[model samples]
Target: MGQGEPGDLTGRAFPLGDWGRPAERLDELYRWVERGALETAAWYLADRTGKRRGARVLRGGAAAGAVAGAALPLLDMTGVVGGVAPWGYLALLLGVACVAADRYFGVTSGWMRDVATAQAVQRRLQVLQFDWASESVREVLGPAEGTAGEAAERCLLVLRRFSEDVTELVRAETADWMVEFRTGSAPLGIQAGGVAGGRAAEGAVVPGRLGVPPGGTRPNMPRQRPPEAR
Candidate 1:
């Protein structure tokens, strides 16, 4: 990867570009899509695995806290455990905190969402491979029955369409995630709604958040309609 190459953004499903000839560029475009999709799947799979473990830990912590909180006071009331009853309320509070943290951090839901998105992208990758194959077999060659330029044009068009689809797949997932974070229903990232309206609209990226200066993360491109599936 040279300076300003698209592959520089590791683990990102973003587009790629190269300074090669048209044939080389076309080959590279396909490779980039394949690589990006595979990496996206791998990243999400790893992410979901970690989050699944976190979800289990949170559930266990909450359950243990609740059991201790209840049994400690019971044992004290029965005179089986002498002065330990006073700590029961603290245990109950710990349980409540655990539950709150689970929701706030989206341990379970995030893992589920990651799995879904990863599988979706993987399926799309298969579809793209077959779609390109379908396009390659068509008799759309130039008047010479198989001109190099016309064949390359067709291949480029097919690759471009597939690339756009990949981008849309990622963008849709991102939009869903942003909406969840901002909406009050998730009990997660509620401040995002307020922050987006108040701070972000003023062209100021929150410090230590996103780490990208205003307009540097991605071009503020218009919403694109899904490309026709060919």
Candidate 2:
């Protein structure tokens, strides 16, 4: 579909007629989606539907406030111009109260939106971690016989260590967001640790020689014995 047009059920083009072309319709759809329309839609579809009712009630309260607000000025003007409307001032007060109540409810909805966004992000990260761990494990241990399984196990151990490290990093980030939301402050910096010693030791081993550095000037000369002759 073109920009701004709402797509049909299969995301095909659907012209919205003189309602400002397909592109405008699509833009409106995206605007609604970003503004919690999907969650609101689900709430409407639920059997219990208490949240939907509550939202309707809040909206009705806001509408009542808006109507009262509009009427208050006219009532005040009439009163000042020698019109005998004793309840005009009271109406103005009620309108102000309604507007304040509407604002409070709006803030509540905003907080709920933040929570929903956080939960969605958490689910996405969990799926990513699962896939990464599974693939890394398979890659490290998917060949050879008997002893090969042991090597794979070692690899998995190292992978889990790294995964845990990465998970801590993610948790720190999540915590930072929470802290910022609650206190309006940034989190302190964290220190980095050295690599795991096991992996470092494994890197030191070389084929046909123990504890030999690659491309170093060490004089290692005896490598003639076959397995049977050794």
Report every candidate's CA lDDT. 0.56, 0.37
Model 1 alpha-carbon drift over 4 Å, by segment: 1-25, 136-154, 183-230
- Which candidate's TM-score is highest? 1
Q: lDDT by residue for model 1 over 1-230, one digit each (tens)?
A: 01242333334343466645665666677787677667656655766777899889888889988998999999999999888787887888898888888777777766665566566556666777887776555533324466767777877766555445444444443444554555512322111111111112221111111111111112246989999999
Q: Write the per-residue lDDT of candidate 2 for residues 1-230, one digit (tens) a residue.
A: 00122221122122243533533443443333223323322321331234345556666765675665556567667675344244545555665665555444433333333333233323433444464456446545664444644644554444444333333332333343344445433332222221212222222111111111011112247889667864
- State model 1's lDDT: 0.56
Q: Estimate each model's TM-score.
A: 0.58, 0.30
**Model 2 scores what on Cα lDDT?**
0.37
